[model samples]
Target chain A: MNDRKTTQDWMKDWQALQRQYWTAWADATRGASGEAPDPATPWHEGLEQWARLFGDASKQSETAERLLATAKNYVALMQSMLAAATGKAAGDAAAPAWTEALRNGLNLPGLDAALHDNPLARMLRELRGPGAQAIDQLSASFAPFLARAREEGLAWLGAPALGYTREHQEHYQKMAAALLDYQDAVNRYNALVLKASRRSFEIFEDKLAERDEPGRRIETLRALYDLWVDAAEEAYAEVALSAEFRKVYGNVVNAQMRVRSQIQQEVERIGVDLGMPTRSELNSVHQRLHELRRTLRRRDDDALVELRRELERLRTEVEALRRRPAQAKPAAARSAARKAVKTGNARK
Target chain B: MGPIHIDPQRAVAELTTFNQKLAAGLKTLRSLDEVDYGATPREAIYREDKLVLYRFRGETSPTAKTPLLIVYALVNRPYMVDLQHDRSLVRNLLARGEDVYLIDWGYPDLSDRYLTLDDYINGYIRRCVEAVAKRCNVEKINLLGICQGGAFSLCYASIHPQTIRNLITMVTPVDFHTPDNMLSHWTRGMDVDLFVDTLGNVPADLMNWCYLTLKPVRLFQQKYVGLVDILDNKEEVENFLRMEKWIFDSPDQAGEAFRQFIKDFYQANKLVNGGLRIGESEVNLRNITMPVLNIFAEQDHLVPPSASRPLQQHIGTQDYTELAFKGGHIGIYVSGRAQREVPAAIHDWLAAR
Candidate 1:
């Protein structure tokens, strides 16, 4: 009996120790890593006291052993749970109904509880809680009603099963009919109004015509004569100004020919007076100009052919004037001219 | 005991023939080089004016069911696919009788500074897709998006699933938090606001410099050193020049688009979380139900394996294949090794489907 009492006492202590170990392990594993526990008052003293109470070397070692054993068992239990849930266990023995009961209690209808017990499914359930069940219930309750309502609503709305509604068609048709009626009414009203207005305007117009008929006739004749005169004057001016008109008139014919001849002679005379060169002369001049340019570019020659030509023309004009003997002065200037010639010869 | 003398006439004849063939081949290559490299064409895919899509009429008759619309990233020219005769991905696809349409994102300018995600995803991309559909006289088109374009394409496909026939994404990043990805680590501490503010549109040169800096020792020193060794051979020289031209050809990313990409996709990880918004529509990955073929380079440094692996898991499509090519990021396009593997895989997959 004493031995039995000792065994019972040891078993009680072992159980208590196991519970404490598991509690600590659970707290350590679940809690944040690298976190300091709450500071005790007089830190070192509190630690000493803690060491004396729970952190005793011998007792701590025993606790660690118990904790490891508890963890092993916990892992084994988890493995067994996973295996059973996945239906990997031997024999046709059904899995424990606790999983189903849990699922049912959570109101997860149509869910496979066995599948839900796995880590991945648990995570999914946490994320979307038995949404399928809720959806299924909603669908089951409302599907038929929704279908019936949709059919009846479609019919009530007057929509074609495959296309748009007759209301749409009728609305457009009514609009078109109304527009056509309005157009017809407007046309009829406009025609009648226009006829009445036209008759009224005709009467007014007749009165106006009666009031101004004589003046109008006189004005018309005056206007006609004025238009004829104006047209005749314009025609006469046009004919007089035209070359054909000049030819027909024959007036100033010799004077115009003489003027033309004089203008041509003046142009030729001016060309000769200016010593305007011929084509070949111009070509030679251009060639001389080019040679001059090339000489200038080379910075060699100073003489320019253009200057020589101008000097030669001037000398020829002077000599010609001299040769003409100044055309002999008039009688009043004969004495002066003779004096000038004597002075010129004396200067020469 | 016999000294062989040179066959001078035969040698000369052979040399002449080789030269003629070489000249002919070069002429053909030059004709094929229609796309202007290095300089961005004044007219690009997303220019403000009318969007003109280039259609390469291949030798084989086109199967007029649905033309494939290839959406390439704005970071580089789309002509990388049509680089040269031997190294051209677009040419290979065309050779296989595939009617391919590419979105040549014209280089964005200052006026495009205000261009945002909505503009690209809803405006430009949607318009391009619609245009392709109209041109092909089909209701839908196959979409193949590369790199950043893949991400944008994914968003577009999610929003407009009805307009897509098949989806192909190459070197696309879906999960931003993948371990061992250098880009992810580098981006984590990046001051994106500072970058966007300082540069407006992130300059292509700066991006290229940073990318090259990732392997600075090899890129700056060894690449040119290797080139010097191959300069004697004419074919090798031409090949080197072509690759160099393709490499330096870069395009500036629009500022607002870059900002949104960094903030939403990179920093916030919004795509994987189903929080990405393309215009007013939510971009849910589960909406991608079309046949998907995801190709990733196993030896890629820029886009690590982890960066692209999650696509297979996240997408809702059952007819999905993950093709792993043992190459770097660029090898998928220009490497001789990929000339057989990548294009063949895509061709076979597309043909089978």
Candidate 2:
């Protein structure tokens, strides 16, 4: 009876605290854009209000975007802990409920169900730092071609072309085939990533079990989040260092390169037809320039070698002159002659 | 009890504080302009193609006669050594009366795609070394190589041992076949020829992506999460931005160099296993008879300590000294502990020699 009363009292207090949290968020947003946040919505959704307030105009949009991206996950984790704490019944095992909360909370709302409970996958997807965007842009440009290639299958790829456009037909077929290969490679890589994510939870539970001791217990949301990160990274490192990952990672890269090579060839052909300088022509020039530079450097090296040899010979003669001090007049005359010859050589 | 004991009221308070800090931090971050690095003043002593040899000017004249030429990895900028006033390796080295010089390998475009590892080791590096030596009126200079540049330096030092007085390699991989070497492991399975032929020049972004993937959870998510703690601190934010700029500001690697490096060092494991050739000259690590100081990070994931610890086995130096830094790869150059320990260790080693 006492336990039931305490549970009721705790529930009332939790509701009151949640209202206070929403009021704080709403007040925070009110000064920015006057959008009062709905208390019914998930706590992390408050960031969207801030995101809109900042818009694309903020100078730190990139940093803000990255922060918001990770913050959303962080906030969701916080919300989960809060919810789990509020719903906890007396005598329940503490770690399991929090662990369960973390697992479910990682699957943030509005994420594709396929990526549910897989935070690593979502993190990887958002990790388009600087130069990475170019690859994504290139992939986006080829989306239509890839889609068509996927839908059409490989039936027509092997069919012999009889017309004058046979070479062109074969090129198209190669491009399509390469595209399919790339997709397959990506799928394999994703499967490995998914495997790592699943293993991370197992690691997290083991890590949590260790924290069950006095003074080691996680007492804050940040500490819990940090622990989870540690678990995820440990699991990831295991997968990344595996031979299977090595082969899969290589295949994805090589497959992408092949697809890119096919595309470049196609682009080159179009460039040649359009009278624009092709990559081949530019490459030839660059190769020649590189060769020329090497040749010039070699020539300079040879000249320096020759000069050093001449200097060594001159030094030997000077040493011989020093030894022939008995014939002082002739040696001095010879030295003078050598100086005159060197001066004449300089003029020449 | 349980693993978690987060009070409900404290959780709400923490979340509210996080939100407030985020708002303030974003505003501060927005108000900030682009961050600048390279704390010490430097004069460009030599320019060859896109490569510039810079000699750093310290407040006091260098007491050391021989200049120390830093050979940085082609994958990133050399400014990392001189990242900031407080966190600079170059500054600390200079303060210790060591003459500091660096090779700034500018961005490589399509025109540079044909440049090979031989071209890098024997061509650009050779000329830079010569320039530093000639300017300093010395026959040989102390060569300090970092990461991939360390590998290049090893090959260069071996091939032309006469030009290096003392060689220092920081977080450099000597044994590429170490089981902990994920980069080498991945490259071992790659068709480097196909990769180079297709890409012309390896995109910096692709390289960064590969590096980030090595520790995705920590690098991508955890790092940003940690950033929230320091968001409100303008000074910390500036420091973070500077480091961020350095991290992503990478050069597109010359394709031919990329191909040869991967094939020879990574796939073949030739640097340690023998039979490595740079250009026409075969690199024999046994030929690096100079006084050697090998500094490697204890927690370095990029170049595992196992990979870096084998310099003594391969090199001909009887005076080989190794310093295991108590940090990760980047920390060896920028961390406060690094600022204190690395330069002092390097200076003391050089002085002893």
Candidate 3:
């Protein structure tokens, strides 16, 4: 009977605490120009409301968007921890229950199911800089071809073809093979990432257990979140710095390049069919231009070197000629030559 | 007892304050204008193709007889040194009455796909050094190389030591096969020919993506999470935005140059093991007999200190000096401590010689 009463009292306190959170969120967003907050919605909705209201299309929009994304995840974490806090006594039942809560918090609603628990994958997906194509986006574009390739075996890939379209058929087979290789590499990379993610959780649990000591306990949502980040980064670095990861990373990059090369070839073919200029044609022109420039530069350099030699030779000759006047003509000879010149002038 | 000890009411209060800060910070972020870099005044002294050599103008006449030519890496823009007024390395160096000149390696397009490392180091850098020396009426000029530029400088100095007075290298990677060098490890297995053949020029975005992946959780997520604390401050937001602009602003590397760099420097470990060539000239670090000052950041992840500390072992300079910085690669240029220490250190070291 006493236990039941205690449960009822805690439940009441939890309800009251939730009401206070909503009230605080409403007040936070009240000044901003957005719709009223729904009490039933997640706490991050308040942030979304503020973002929607103040996030103008400006230069800072990208930064704002990134901040909003991370902030939403952080707010979700806060909400999860608060819920966990009310469900149990403070500093009690923190390991398993809070760990589960933290996991649920990160796997927030409305995220793609693939990225539900894999924050590393999500980070990879969103980590691309401006003007850089996301690898995930590229993979999505090639999904249909990859899927079709998987369904069909490679037995026919090596078969000889004797028809007008034989070359095209062979090219398609090569593209499919490259796609399969790329998929394999991506799978290996993802497996490592998954391992890292699992290890991160184990590390997080251990870290939390360490914090059980007096004065070392995590007392706030931000502190707990930071601890989780530390654990996540530590686990990620261990995996990323491993020799196996280096091989996998290289394989993924090389495979992707091959796949891209094949796609570019196919696109060039299509472009040629449409009577448009192709990458191959442009590359040929660029290569020729580059060669011409190199030749011109080399010639220019050679010419410059020859000119310097000529200039030095002329300088040496001039120095020698100036010395000849001093050496070949003595002072007495100069006087006699002057007198002879004067006499010749008189005769003229 | 368990770990977390969050009081529900206190957590709600914290969240409320966080939301308020976010709201105010967004307003500040919106009100700010586009950030501009390169704080000091500069004049273009020479131009060839897309590359330009600029001589920075200081408040007074430079006291140094020999001009210090900064050979910046081609992977990123050179303006990182002169990013802003307070954080500008160029500005600080100029303030110390040092004549500063920099080589601006302009963005490479598809047409520049065939530009080889020989073209960059021998053709562009050599000419720029000559141009700076000619303009200053000096036979030899001081060389200060930053990051990849430092490697290029080492090669240039090795091949043509007579043209250099004093060589200063900042955060340069000498031994590429160091155990802690992640970038080198990842590139060891890559087929450079295939990479360059497919991508005419390495796009800056791809390079940035690779860099961010080095520490994804911290760089992509936690960094922004920490930004929420400073969002409400306009000054802080501007600082953040300036850094953001510089972080993403990068140049597409010339394909052939990138290929050779990755193959020779990262894969072959030639800078340390010898057998490096720029154009027709062989690069032997032993030929770098000039007074050398090697400055490396201790915490630099891009170019680990382990990779940089091997310089003293490889070079044949009897007057070699090493200065260990207490920061990372970028921080060594832009941090407050850098502003206080780096320019002064370079100036003092150069002044002594």
Candidate 4:
């Protein structure tokens, strides 16, 4: 578990490191708060705010660890269940056929080894590896910038101005705090997904096992195929309906958006320095065009409404003239009759 | 001893047939230059910003006074309703001697990315209804909304109830946040703004991926495995290709509209909750006072019957009728049962109304 090379081991190490970071950060905050540089300006606000973010990150890391552990256990359970069923028929054709079917279903390597070890775990390991790798890359990229900021922040607490005026210092600290919070939310989301996916497959297996009764037994390959679909939908329905899924889903996405927004802000700041138009400017234009189009539509609607009214009025006048000359009905009377006929026909 | 029983002869027979058919199917696939559809004769009577409104002329003439307009969802092309002559809902409606019109919300592009839901429901649909009414010389036209189009039609009827004599919603989700709503669940937390901004118009490939992943083993794997049975039948192969084309022929969703749809409908669940607004007009379900024909597929994974069932409690229409279509979402439009039951039900309902 202490090793940081394998997926689970590395994730566990990351969580522990985050906890240590949070502890160190919190200690700094407490040290800052215990002393006052001048009383006129509170130096601890910036430090303490960032400290809370680190604390949130630590909490999220712990939560994700718990969920991931649950997921790992679930994977182990599925491996055991699958092994129990397949191991009985191992020496026969049925076992080999089932293995072939499973291998095809998984479409992943290490199948032979996975059968002996844990197929579900191997599958999950491969599934999560790429995403984990990408996240690690991004985290590494952000590390240097964060390290510099941390140094600047700690020194500024003891140095002149404490980074800036009260408002600016607070805003910067709050933003840093948010960055940590976002990362935590992402971790929580990732962990939740791992657990949810493992749970989903387990549910599928459970339902498939249930269909082993006499009358409802899966008799054919087609039946097994159908069972897979039924089981998947059933599993999806369960996870989809759960309150935890919804909460974590929202948390993860919102956090990702927040992190993206911060990155976009930095990009915009750099763009502004280079005299380039940012997304905000384009958005403003889009907003204006949207409003203008709506206005044009409203104008068109009004004109159409007015035209209809004018048409009706002209028809009324024409009908009046025709009535004076011949036995033609008045426009009002004719329109009324038409409506009556329409409603009457509908009623039929 | 083995855990299960097997019929070796039956298995061998099936496998042999499957292999032979699969070979024939490849040749048939190569021979198929194009699987053309929309067999029913129609003329584009109106065109607005890539959307063309076609008025269908059926074999039989003028049984129903009001023309029926089919409004299909933007998620996919409308040709699913008119897939082919035998499987076509449009043809079926036509054969029933009903005047029919269809609004083809054509493939949206970069220029159309600015088009919002307001532009779709209020602007495009409203104008199309008016055009159909004028063309038929009637005060109102009958509207049939399929899936998301049904949702749009609901919004339209709410806004201008007078323009639609009858409103039919097929496999439409009225309640967005239902417990079994997988689509809503997945989209509830999505960063729609970022997604839209990044993609401009949502890519069809991505949209297809999202849908296909819902039941990956079934949609992608099992279905292909089952395909072996019908692979030798050229007709069946053609039918399958036509459907496969339609399934993959998803148009890019307009960016602004996609943004609003995901945020307002999927994320907020505003339509069912009485706070949905397209442009400026609030979509109050109470305003849907016209006769409503609500049809839902029994086993639709996309829009569960529970999602459509809430419309019974919400609408102001006392003249509401519900039909339980015994199929999935796609099957309700093309299955043989649908060919017989659906259009007939619609024809009879419209005639009575």
Each candidate's chain B TM-score?
A: 0.85, 0.99, 0.98, 0.97
Report the lDDT tens digits of candidate 2 across residue range B1-353: 66777777787888888887877788788898889898999999999889999999999999998899999999999899999999999999999999999999999999999999988999999999999899889999999999999999999999999999999999999999999898888898788999989888998988998899888878887898889889989999999989999999999999999998899889999999899989899999999999999999999999999999999999998999999999999999999999999999999999988
Using all chains and alpha carbons, the TM-scores for the candidates as numbered come to 0.44, 0.94, 0.93, 0.69
lDDT of 2 by residue, A1-348 (tens): 123557668778677767878887766555774655566678788887777767766666777787887887788888877777666542245556667888878887678876887877777877755543554576668788777755777678778877999999999888777877877887898888899998898889899889888878877788888899898998888888899999998898888888888989999999989999998899999999999989998999999999999999999999998887889888789999999999999999
Query: What DockQ number belongs to candidate 2?
Result: 0.51
Model 1 residue A160 lDDT?
33
Candidate 2 stretches with Cα past 4 Å from truth are: A1-11, A27-30, A89-91, A128-153, A327-348
Ranking by DockQ: 3, 2, 4, 1
Which parts of model 1 are misplaced by more than 4 Å?
A1-348, B1-52
- Note the DockQ of each predicted structure: 0.00, 0.51, 0.58, 0.07
Instruction: Point out the higher-scoring one by DockQ: 2 or 3.
Output: 3
**What clash count does candidate 4 reach?**
0
User: By DockQ, who's the top model here?
Assistant: 3
What is each predicted model's overall lDDT from 0 to 1?
0.54, 0.87, 0.86, 0.68
* Candidate 3 lDDT (Cα, 0 to 1): 0.86
What's the distance in Å from true for residue B141, model 4? 0.9
Off by over 4 Å in 3: A1-5, A31-36, A54-56, A94-97, A128-145, A313-328, A331-348
Candidates in descending lDDT order: 2, 3, 4, 1
What is the DockQ of the complex in model 1? Answer: 0.00
* lDDT at residue B18 of model 1 (Cα atoms): 28
